[model samples]
Target: MKHINLLLLLIVTTITIVLLWQGAQTREKESQLLEVISRHSKASDPSKSSDLTRNSAPGGAARPSAAAFEPDHFLTELNSLLDSAGTDSRTVQRAMRMFLFDNKGKLASASPKALKEACNKIEADWATDAKSFVWLELVSEIVKSDPAWAIRNIDRFLMTIAKEQPMEKMLHYLGKNGRLGDPAWSPEYAAELEKWFDTAEADGRLKGMDEEAAGMRFDLNISLGNLLGAVEQLTHLPEDSLSTRLEDLAASSSAPSGQRGLVEAVAAAVPATDFQDFTRALSQHAGFDSARELLARAELTAERHDLAAAGIAAADIGPQTAARADWLITTLRDKDAGAVTGFAAAWTQAAHKDTAAWLTSLPAGDARDAAVAGFAPAIARLDGATAAKWGLTLENPSLRTSVMDHVYREWHQQEPEAAAEYFGR
Candidate 1:
């Protein structure tokens, strides 16, 4: 009778423990919709939130599963709303804005004819009010539903234009639905664009309307990067001769400087034997110009058995190497060739010498910061042989806590036993 009571008590305790654990899990798994859907049918950007917790200083707010925010629900609601509408353009425009906010090809089964009719309906009835927008949604639909139509209608729907016209936004979409769809630009359109550029150069938005001009220039700056990226894809510039066009782009005064900077960064990705040449080319940006490129170079150098060169290159990359660490530990591994001491020392110096300065130089933005924070954990996850080699080769005691914590916290939940072994728990 006493034994039965003991078993019963144990069973009750186990059930209580399991129930508590499940409750905590459920709490952690908040419904993403109830949390942030200003309404049931639109994707309110988390960026709009005034709450500091939503945009925490570091490590980011814990994300609920991204998949939980289903576009299908919004699309279903949109279709039902559209079906009941009474030929109202404002109503149609509102529906389109909702559709665009959750743009993920939800109604992908609709045919090309249906898409054309949809585009026509939106174009004819799109609202002139600042209170709502449907053009971006319509443009996104045309782009995905039919790239050919996107190409054909490129002139009709560009979001930005140098000058305001009664229907320029619609025409902009028709021209570059996907990149100057009509390869042969009408001479008249070319002349118009040229005239716009001349106005930008002469009266110059700087003197005429500085604020609006600056905004327009900012938009133009972004467009040029995509334009050049598209051009590169279409041309498929050979690996060896990649820099020629890039050089041309940088030297062209009309080439947007921001776009040129991006082009310079991408060109640095081309694999090559001469580290010196690649480093020299990318250093022009003044924005820790060599961080990502040098990180890549360090990997290549370690692979080539040029340990001294790799170390020097890593040092040149400075502290930002720790943040630009897309693959620092992997870069150091260099196959199963075991560890190279020089590469390890170089990396330690680059990361530890000026920790704050190095963090400062890395890419800006929340995602970049999180990766920077994880740099140590990344190094901790190195294979056993490499980790041991790394331990013996370096002497930075300050770094151990971060590296160990990164590994233990990361691996513990997923593989607790292995994580215990990793942290020597």
Candidate 2:
């Protein structure tokens, strides 16, 4: 009997110790949960509630009721928790998005004023510039459903911390949605955008950028193509003002060559009646190199071919002609060899006052021989006997043979009997 009582007492003592340890662990878990709830409640309240209102037990700590676990309350507490924990901005943003997704039904039913207030809260709490931009984007989306709100806030807070990306995205969105030209939103929005571009250009903000980057930043191709289109559609600005603005944009040397090319192409598209004045304006404002390049490009155009020929004929034999001589030669080579010979003869006559003297002064090589060959046909056509005499004077054997063959062909075709007697001699 004594052994049995001692064993039972030992078992009882062990059970008591285990129970006490379990109780302590349970209390510790409860304390941790309460602390979490307290922090959550504090973070959720803007004023930070000091009073710990909870269901208290006799001689025990306060405990939260099921009321605190309501869906809306839980989301608020979670948001507050995330914000106060100094979580990364993107992480917080994602978490908030998830919360919205989970409670999308509630959000859908929420009033506009409530939604705006919530967006304002998000804007105020988020730390990063990216978060602020996201808030604005959200606002834009929300206001799209409310046209009155959109009109009121379209220009307000339109800018983002990122230099141009947000505005560009917004503009693209507006254009894609056909809201940019909406009469209900007022034409002032488009005007505001134009003014912004003008201001940026004047401030040199768009200057000195690399070609590809500047093209993207300024929407160079799209803007230039649509410049007149905008004036016609928007009607907020005069055509003359827009034209002057385009001229200013084109003349900026800091802009890329492609931009200048677009300007030159537009000028070339002008009617013949206005072409002279257009070119004159370009020359006055776009500098000498640009003017020269514009003229060269214009000369290459199909419509200006005759004009190009006339201009080349009238052009003096100077540095300008020399500079353009290669292009002119290449252009004329495929069209008419006679014209090429005539141009060369003209250049020589102007420079040296004698084509034969210019030909003799040329260096002895294939280049000079080619020049002789090029001029031979024209010379033969003019006077075959004189051409044959000049052919014998050529130092290059190949050139002499080629010129003689050409002269004989012409002399034979023109006067075979005289050619037969001259050959027999």
Candidate 3:
């Protein structure tokens, strides 16, 4: 009987402990749920409006209120309400802020020391209660007003930011406000910022950054190339490296021909004085135009005494692309009327796509248009329908319109009645 009683007592104790533990967990969960509900309920509660404003002011401080800010109260006994809600930090913060705004007289009465203490508490608790950006704003205001506390704790508090999404918001706030460049800029901080920037740039996800938040803080605060140190840490690239890591990627020959433009553009923008040699050495596939551009830069100008290299550059232009951007100028001044029509045919085919891109990419002026227009007769043969559609997407709208009108005239000479249907009513 004694053994059985002892065993029963042990079992009862264990059951009681388990019940208590579960009850405690239930209470904790309930409390957390209530906290969330309280946040939303307070936000929507019309009565909290005045409270929110007063506390949001720069120096709004909490004070002894004339009456308890309404919160749920539980009755302890007759004529006694247990003050379940009075003086909670969040409640106090909102009410004090609202009261301060509603009556500056109340704010004026707050002692400076008290105000500072209240601000510190509210700011310290912000990361737990407010949005992450809210904490940034709170810290920023705190740092601006109370650099003493910030200088001491900013590092510790900032770790909370890394866990948040859209970390750029926090980074931008710090970077733009000059905090990123502060004496606190450690090697670890710089390395992380560079990693984030390179990742964002690589993924093409850098668009969310506002113009003011464009560059990393180090980029703004340090010398232009100083951020190179962090990038160097990544891959220990060459001393004169200018190309991004992506420049190394090559497309397989089986890829679509349309992808050629993107590949060529990336390769051209890459930093390589000897790109023609490097690319040819790397793969069976390479863009001849890009190769020619590299070699052309090595050509000597008459001014530079490298004129020997100019002919070399011209030769490298690969018969396909160099199809004569050269003398066609004086040629199209084609003083020969019969040769004019023939020249037009060749020019139209070469200049079909990105014609305006080519024209504008050159030195600007009416001169270029006049020269390119000499090929207009060629363009006419290329597209009668496109010529008719000119009013829509023409470059140099006025000049193109006139050119179209002239082409119409020429077409009229060839077949006047047929041309009327194109250019005329």
Comparing 2 and 3 by TM-score, which wins?
A: 2
Residue 344 error for model 3, in Å? Answer: 21
425 Cα displacement, candidate 2 (Å):
42
lDDT, model 2, position 262: 49
Q: Candidate 1: deviation at residue 125, Å?
A: 3.7
Query: Which candidate achieves the best TM-score against the true structure?
Result: 2
Q: Write the per-residue lDDT of candidate 1 for residues 282-306, one digit (tens) a residue.
A: 3433223334344334324344433
Best by lDDT: 2
Which of the two, 1 or 2, has more lDDT? 2
| Candidate 2 residue 357 C-alpha distance from true site, Å | 44
The TM-score measured for candidate 2 stands at 0.29
TM per candidate comes to 0.26, 0.29, 0.26
What's the true lDDT of residue 313 in model 2?
Answer: 38
Scored by CA lDDT, what does every candidate get? 0.40, 0.47, 0.40
Each model's number of backbone clashes? Answer: 21, 0, 9
